[model samples]
Target: MIKRRLNVLLIEDHFIEIMKFKKTVSFAEIQHSITEAKDGAEAFKILEDKSRMPDLILLDLNMPKMSGVEFLSILKNSEELRHIPTVILTTSDNQKDLEECYRLGISGYILKPLKYKDYATKIEAVLNYWSLNELKKY
Candidate 1:
């Protein structure tokens, strides 16, 4: 069976983090089309335009302009955009941040692993789980 290619929107501020994420995904062998945004503001702009909207979103917590929680608040409130699933992919293991993300209805929260191989494994697990899950019509 052929694996499905995912359209992923990645909101990350750090270039190095983005590079790690890409490398992990590649190592996992997950076929995906990723759209990168430097911060929550940029990601929100992309979300506003329906044509550029993604199948899923992986957000970073602490970002310039707007935070991940701020973006999630708007995203969950929007009737046109609420159906899309979003997960928190961040280095922050802060309890408050985790609680806030859960309260805002994030699909999952993953703390970034320090090891590259471990990171790739976690990413692969996420991809596998989501691939088997069904999405609602947007």
Candidate 2:
């Protein structure tokens, strides 16, 4: 299967986590465009530009300014943004958080694994699936 190069928006707060994700992508040798946002507020600013919207969003539940749930709520409510596929990439294994994310119409929810290899594998699978799957273009 031909792997499509995806435009991805990664909404995360921790600098180390961000670097880890970038390193994974680089190590995996996946040619993808990744946009980073420190928090929901920053993500919102980036999302405002419809012309440059990402194909997929990887959101972290814990963030400053606005939590992932809060961000998801607003995004899901917006007709213009609701269709974009958002997958939660979080360490929280709380059932409530998982249920809430699904209730808010998240595309997928994945817990960050402790091991770097495990994390990389999960990320690779996610990117592969989304890249191969058909997405709605607005």
Best TM-score among the predictions, by candidate number: 2
lDDT of 1 by residue, 11-56 (tens): 9999989998888777655678889999877887887777767888
Which runs of model 2 end up more than 4 angstroms from their true locations? none
List ranges where model 1 is wrong by over 4 Å.
none
> What overall lDDT, based on C-alpha atoms, would model 1 receive against the true structure?
0.84
Q: Residue 33, candidate 1: how far off, in angstroms?
A: 0.6
* lDDT per model vs. reference: 0.84, 0.94
Q: What is the TM-score of each candidate against the true structure?
A: 0.91, 0.97
RMSD of each: 1.6, 0.9
Error of 2 at 26 (Å): 1.1
What 10-residue stretch in candidate 1 is worst by lDDT?
129-138
- Give lDDT tens digits, candidate 2, residues 19-86: 99999888655688999999999999999998889999999999999999999999999999999999
Model 1, TM vs. native: 0.91
Give per-candidate clash totals. Answer: 0, 0
Clashing pairs in 1: none
Q: How many clashes would you count in candidate 2?
A: 0
